[model samples]
Every structure is written in structure tokens, then in C-alpha cells.
Target: MTWYRRYGRWSLLLSWAPFVGDPLTIVAGTLREPLWSFVAIVAVAKVARYLAVAGATLNLI
Candidate 1:
């Protein structure tokens, strides 16, 4: 609770982490983060990660 809010917006970035990412999402829910904002943050982070990986795999990065 306190830990999640402590990080504030930065916590949204943690959604990209491996095992810890799920917990961070749960924390986001428990903290009642703005729905669209939370979705946008997580989606962008994950999509950016996948795009980076795809680019690297294709030797574009």
C-alpha cells in the first residue's frame, strides 16, 4: 500500500519487470490507480519492450 504510493508514477514503470511485475499491477489495483492511465502506462511499457526485442532480433537496434 504505502510502498506502491511511495513510488507514485514510477511504480507504473515497474510493470515491465519479470516476476515482480504482476505484484506491481496488483498494487496498482489496490491503490486504485486511474483506469485508463494505468492501462496506458502498462500497455506502452510492455509494447515498447516487445518492439525493442523484435527490433533487436531483426538487427534493427
Candidate 2:
């Protein structure tokens, strides 16, 4: 709960982290974060992660 207050909108970025990312999403909901902000942040983070992984895989191949 305290973490929610501390993070505010920035908490959406936590959604990209490992294991704890899921729970942070739940916390974001409870904190009433802006829907569009959460969507946009998470979308960008996930997309970036995918791109990085793809680049690494291509390099390895």
C-alpha cells in the first residue's frame, strides 16, 4: 500500500519486471492509476523487451 503511494504512475513501469510485476499490476489497480497510462507504459516496456530478445536471438543464430 505504501509502495503504491510512493510509485504513483511510475508503478506501471514495474509491470515489466519479473515475478513481482504481476502483483505490482494488482497494486496499480488498487491505487487507481490512469488506465491509458498503464496500458501505454506496459505496452512499450513489453515491446522493448521483445525487440531486445529478438535482436539477441538473431545475433546468436
User: What's the lDDT for all of these models?
Assistant: 0.84, 0.79
lDDT score, candidate 2: 0.79
Query: In candidate 1, which residue pairs clash?
Result: none
- Candidate 1 per-residue lDDT, tens place, 1-61, comes to 6767677857787687799888888878887888988999899888988998999999999
> Over the stretch 1-61, how does candidate 2's per-residue lDDT look in tens digits?
7767876777777676799788888877877788898889888877877787898989952
Model 1 residue 43 distance off true place after TM-score fit, in angstroms: 1.3
Clashing pairs in 2: none
Measured against the true structure, the TM-scores of the candidates, in listed sequence, are 0.83, 0.80
Each candidate: how many clashes?
0, 0
Angstrom error of the Cα, residue 53, model 2: value is 1.0
Off by over 4 Å in 1: none
Cα TM-score of candidate 2? 0.80
TM-score of 1: 0.83
Error of 2 at 3 (Å): 1.8
